[model samples]
Target: MSLKVEFDEPKCVAAGQCVMVAPDLFDQRDEDGVAIVLDDSPSPDQYDEAREAAAVCPAAAIRLVEG
Candidate 1:
C-alpha cells in the first residue's frame, strides 16, 4: 500500500491538532504556528495514525491518499 500526505499552508489555522495527534508525522515550525508535514510519505506502521491525525485536524489541512 502507498499513502501520501499533503498539507495546505494557507488553510491551516495553527491549531496544532495534527501535531498533537501524530508528532512523528507532523511538526510545528518555530517561525510559524502552522503544522508542517514531517514525513508526507509515512511508513506503513504510521499509516493509520497519520490518517487519524488528518481526520482530527480542525482546519482540515491534511490530505491523505491511499494506493
Candidate 2:
C-alpha cells in the first residue's frame, strides 16, 4: 500500500493542527505559517498520524490519497 499527502497553501489558516498531529509529515513555513508537505509519500507507520492531521486541520488543507 502507498499513500500520498497533499497540502493546499492558499487554504491554510495557520492553525498548526497538522504540525501538532504529525510534525514529521507536515510543517509550517517560517514566512507565512502555511502548512507544507514534508513527505509526499509516507510510510505505513505514518498513515494514521497523517489522517489525524487532515482530520484536525481547521482549514482542511491536508489531503490524503491512497493507491
Candidate 3:
C-alpha cells in the first residue's frame, strides 16, 4: 500500500536530485555532496516523484522497496 526507500552510501555519487525532488523526504549535505534521508515515510502522493528521482540518479544509489 506504500513504498520504502533505502540508500547505499558507498554507491552514492552526491547528485542532489532526490532531495530537490522531495525536500520532505531527503536532504543534501552540500558540504559533503551526499544525500541524507529526512523522512522515511513520504506521503503517497509523493511516491511517483520519488521513484522518478531514483530513476534519474546518476549513481543509481536509490532503492525502491514496494510495500
* lDDT against the true structure, each candidate: 0.89, 0.90, 0.82
Q: Select the stronger candidate by lDDT from 1 and 3.
A: 1
lDDT of 2: 0.90
- Candidate 3 stretches with Cα past 4 Å from truth are none
Q: Pick the candidate with the highest lDDT.
A: 2
Q: Give the lDDT ranking, best first.
A: 2, 1, 3
Residue 29 error for model 3, in Å?
1.7
TM-score of each: 0.93, 0.94, 0.86
True-structure Cα RMSD, model 2: 0.8
Better of 2 and 3 by TM-score: 2
Best by TM-score: 2
Worst 10 residues of 1 by lDDT: 28-37
Which residue pairs show backbone clashes in model 1? none
Arrange candidates by TM-score, highest first: which order?
2, 1, 3
